[model samples]
Target: MRHFRISFLVTFILMAVSGWWGYSHGGMPGLINALWITGVLGVMEVSLSFDNAVVNASVLRHWNEFWQKLFLTVGILVAVFGMRLLFPLVIVSVATGLGLVDVWTMATTTPDVYAKHLTDNHAQVAAFGGAFLLLVFLNFLFDDEKELHWLGWAEEKVNALGTESLAVLITMGAVAACVAMGPVEEKYSVLASGIVGIAVYIGVNWISGLLEEGEPDLQDDEEEGAAPAKNGNGDLVKTVARGSIGGFLYLEVLDASFSFDGVIGAFAITNDVVIIMLGLAIGAMFVRSMTVFLVHKGTLDEFVYLEHGAHYAIGILALIMLASVKYHIPEWFTGLSGVAFILVSLWSSLRYRKRHAAQA
Candidate 1:
């Protein structure tokens, strides 16, 4: 109870301070929308990211208290500011003639134009994001540890590049060329980008395996009181092997991935870049903090199927991304689906506890 209280108060203080700062810098309308936008987006993000904490908990069990704190403080910065702050601006600036600062101004001042631009590109954005997420969701269907033999045909095609660096560079060139040819076709860009994302995932996994196989094992540190660290040829595998970063990184990566859609989507909601940033930043921060709380408190362990629920939420988000490109789904539906999932996961946990208590 004491730990829970401390975590809750700490989160409240941080949110309050950030909210006040955003309001002061932005105008009253900006402030008002920021509050509403932040509330809605925050709840949505946190609910969707519950699986992130569950995965983080599994990996975090290896870390000492210091690393845990680092994961909270530094990791949050990486997730919030790096992903939510910098990435969207980078995407918009590169995609559109607008700089992030200008986008911010437009979001606050000339929201309609900003929105129009985003709407213009929504389909391409949706296709790219939708396809990428589709691959991600499909990955869980296969045995994650399986080698790429099943994808042998794809492997041969990808390997024809001779080197991973070349493959990535070639992919980038292709995307750039498509963007440059004016009147960017939504179908083409979406398909290419989607395939590229899947290729990158597979390529990286393959490369990591080869590298790990060549390494020598590290001496066990009895002091650590954790599993033996994997040392390859005296090089410590400092990170988890084979997609082991857990739901946190998945959520973080997907959150950033989702940002392209979100920032693009936000333009439609309101142009006030200040409102967009404040709303989204607050939302991102809250989600990150919520992930931390879930990990620290063992909420997922308490709720056995919560992780599965979050994955389902991701699937929904992916579908929304694809659907938004063409048809309009009510925002209420997007927001409510996530909320409902979280509530159900929570209910499952409570029920489990009650049943266990009665049996005991």
Candidate 2:
């Protein structure tokens, strides 16, 4: 509650301003409609992204204050403006060979045409976003080092394979199938986009791993109650220099991958770009604030399996996005499915705690 005071107040002000702006643009009825749409979209984003918040908190709990603050500030800006606003235009501009300025003008002056162009290339966007997210899900599933298992025997067997690249193999096969099923003209572009997605995920992880490798073991610092005066490799860098930056970048890229669908789906609600921006902005802010709440409240420590649930949801979402290239699925279904997974995982965690207490 204390952590979210500022966010709640800001949320109120933003909603009011959003409503008034809606009224100014669309008159009294439009005012009412705009406010309704914004609120709904905000709720939709929160529902769809509660798993995102949990995953974010899992990453954030490891960071020091500076990195956490950077996530709230810089990361939120990227989620809102960078992915929400600018990313859409970038996708349209690249697809249509239009200048950025021209795309912006089209979005404002001729929204329907802009939307057609946007939706026209949904397959490529889905392929890219889906490929990146599939890798995220697969990597977690195939992690030989992950000790906790929700599906004990199956997970154990999968983990036992111990091969570092099996996840990538499966993901590559999935991408190839999707590409093959796509139109002949789109095969090359689709395959290339997916490869780019895989490459970006690999590149980001490699860079982050390289940076983190130089940092001393965190458990050592916890035992000593001090950051190392010197890092493991005898580098001059401060302890914060390595892990924090790498972790921040990793989380931001993860968030960007998570957000790709939400941003694309926002157009279904309304064609007015400003309304969509404000609506999504409101949701993005709430997610940031919710993450802080989770970290400060130690929710992850209490609800141990919550992170597992979130990842499972990510896996499901990845499959859905891949399947969407062949079949249309509603955004509501995606949001609802994610919420259902989180709820079931929460129940499982509570049951585990109760049984452990009885044994004690």
Candidate 3:
């Protein structure tokens, strides 16, 4: 409860603002509808992002407090404003060659057309997000160092064959297949976007490795004669940043991939970009709060395989989004499937613990 206090306050304040904005645009009816819609959207985002919270906690628990604060503060801001607001607008701007102001006006005044404009590029967006997510999943699966095998033989084999080149080859093959099957007009865009996604992942990973390598380990830092690293803030913020840089970007990209589906799906419920932004932002805030809660309460350690489940769910999502380029999968399907994976993994974790205890 204490962990969620900030999220609750932010949600209330944003909901009120959304209501006021609705009233200003329409009237009493609009106000009521706005509140209802916002609540629904917020809940929807949270449901779709529950696994995201677990994965985030898995990464966050390894970070220092300073980095965690940075995630809660700067990360949330980026999640809310960066992905929620600017990303869609940027897409619209790029597609239509319209200025930001024009895009905003179109989205607000001519919502149907704005949605069309956005949805029209769904293939490229799906391809990019899907490719990135697929790579993430593959990388996790290919982790030969991972000793825990949820599926026993299958996972062990996959991990054994897992290498960077193999993951890239598989991802490229998936993207190529999509491009080959896609419409002639959209094929180039889809292919290019997917390649860009792959490139971005590689670039970020490389940079993270470099940053991490530059920092000394915790044991080395504790040496009496060692001088601590300094940054613009005159502290070990740099060290923490370097150490967790990979995780920071990974989480951000993961959020963006999730946002690709969410931002587009919001149109099904409402055309008002403002309403969608407010609602999704609230949900994102709560998810972040949940991540913190999971970390502070040691939920991940207790659950054991929760992180595995989340990653597996993420893999399904990546495949679904890739499949969605041609077929239209409902948002409900994505959300429910993720929840199912998480719940099953949780049940498995509990059962495993019981069995192990009995054996002991």
**Of the candidates shown, which would achieve the greatest TM-score relative to the real structure?**
3
Give the TM-score comparing model 3 with the true structure, all chains together.
0.96
The worst-scoring run of ten residues by lDDT in candidate 1 lies at 141-150
Q: Tens digits of per-residue lDDT for model 1 on 1-360?
A: 543454456446645654675578676764565566656555555544444444455446445455566566766677667765566555556667877888767655666765666566666666555554544544432323423222356634533433544434544443344334324456576656656665645554566466456434434444556566356732224433322344235445555556665565565555555555555655555555555566667776677656545545555766676666557876567656756765676676677679888999
Model 2, 1-360: lDDT tens digits are: 877776677678768987898888879998899889888878878888898898889888987776777788888889888988888899899988999999999998899898888887777877777787788877877887787777778888877884647777777888898788777887888788778878877887787777777666767777989754555545435445543666677677677766767876888888887778788888888888999889989998898788889988988888888777667899999999999999999998898789888999
TM-score of each: 0.65, 0.92, 0.96
Angstrom error at residue 154, model 2: 1.5
How are the candidates ranked when ordered by TM-score, highest leading?
3, 2, 1
lDDT for each residue of candidate 3 in 265-357, tens digit (9 for 90 to 100)? 899999999999999999999999999999999988788888889988988998888888899999999999999989988998899899999
Give me the runs in candidate 2 sitting further than 4 Å from their true place. Answer: 216-240
Q: How accurate locally, in lDDT, is each candidate?
A: 0.56, 0.81, 0.90
Clashing pairs in 3: none
